[model samples]
Target: MTEPERLRADAVRNRAAILRATEELLAHHHPQQISMEQVAAAAGVGKGTVFHRFGSRHGLMRALMQERAQDLQTAITGGPPPLGEGAPPRARLLAFLGAMVELVARNKGLLAALGPAPVATAPEQEPREEHPVYRAWHGHLSRLIHQQRPDLDDDMLAHVLLATVHSEPILNALEHGAADRLERTLRDLVSGLMPEG
Candidate 1:
């Protein structure tokens, strides 16, 4: 490959390495305790590399979240079945919620770290609505809800459903082996929203 192409490839590899290292560190240390220096050391790159790639700790966490959610995003955007484009709106909504429960269960540590702390909040923190991932999920839900129930306020309802899946109570339930009950409740909530055919 040409010089520029080689550099680009190297950058991609470096980015992946950094994300993997961060994931490893998050598995052991609290997110607040895992610094860029540690990430660089584990990733076999310079501290500057981590900062350069992600800008800050928050940015790194967001990148990690995006990476973890990439597969779900792809399946939603292109893959077949209820999670994708081929199913009814209610079915898609149910599938999406089910997938999100799995995702949140797997990444609760990272997700909790990424969220605002109740004790010490960042004054200039971005709103949840402004986050790209939240926007994508909300937009998808809004569209599906609108398709299923045109008379309802799709935007608010989407937010409510998304909140239900991402709420701390749900996360705690997942941790406590209450996934079956959680799923049933979510399914019932969504099903109740749809008009009977």
Candidate 2:
């Protein structure tokens, strides 16, 4: 291969190796305790490669989170319902929240280690309506909302409803002793807010 092509291929390999190592280690341990050296050892790459690929520990953590978000978006879009399909709107909403809660529970250590990343940024010029994952969740929720409450603006309601489901306040509630209560409250909220026929 040409020299430039070979370098590109190697760069891709390095990034993949680093991400895989980070995911595996973070799955069982907290990010603060997993040093760059340990990640390199786990990936069987030199420590220099980890630094070169990710620039710093924080960058690595951000990449891991972005990867996870993309994976979760796919699974929820295509995996199975109530998470994926075939369930009632309330059931689907509950399942989605439950799945998120379980994921948070499983990754609590890693999350505590990474700290809060800013939740919002400048909107991309590309219309989010055209994005597959955005459309999937928004479309599903919109349809369900319209079915229950035709008087409400489905798009607006879907946005607000999902924002509540994912907001930090709700996550905090789940992390504390209020997960069950929160779930019931969320279902009740959805029921009450949805339009009656």
- Tens digits of lDDT, candidate 2, 1-197: 99999999988888888889888998777678899999999988999989887778876876665566566666667888777767776666667656544555455545555443112212543354454544555677787778666888989977775565346676566557665676566677776785233
Provide the overall lDDT of each model, using Cα atoms, as 2-decimal numbers. 0.81, 0.67
How many clashes does each candidate structure show, in the order listed? 0, 3
Please give each candidate's TM-score: 0.86, 0.63
Compute the lDDT of residue 157 as modeled in candidate 1.
Answer: 90
Candidate 1, position 110, lDDT: 77
lDDT of 2 at 45: 90
RMSD to the native, candidate 2? Answer: 5.0
lDDT of residue 56 for candidate 2:
84
Residue 35 deviation, candidate 2, in Å?
A: 2.6
Tens digits of lDDT, candidate 1, 40-133? 9999999999999999998888788887777788999999988999999989989998887777776766777776321112347666777667
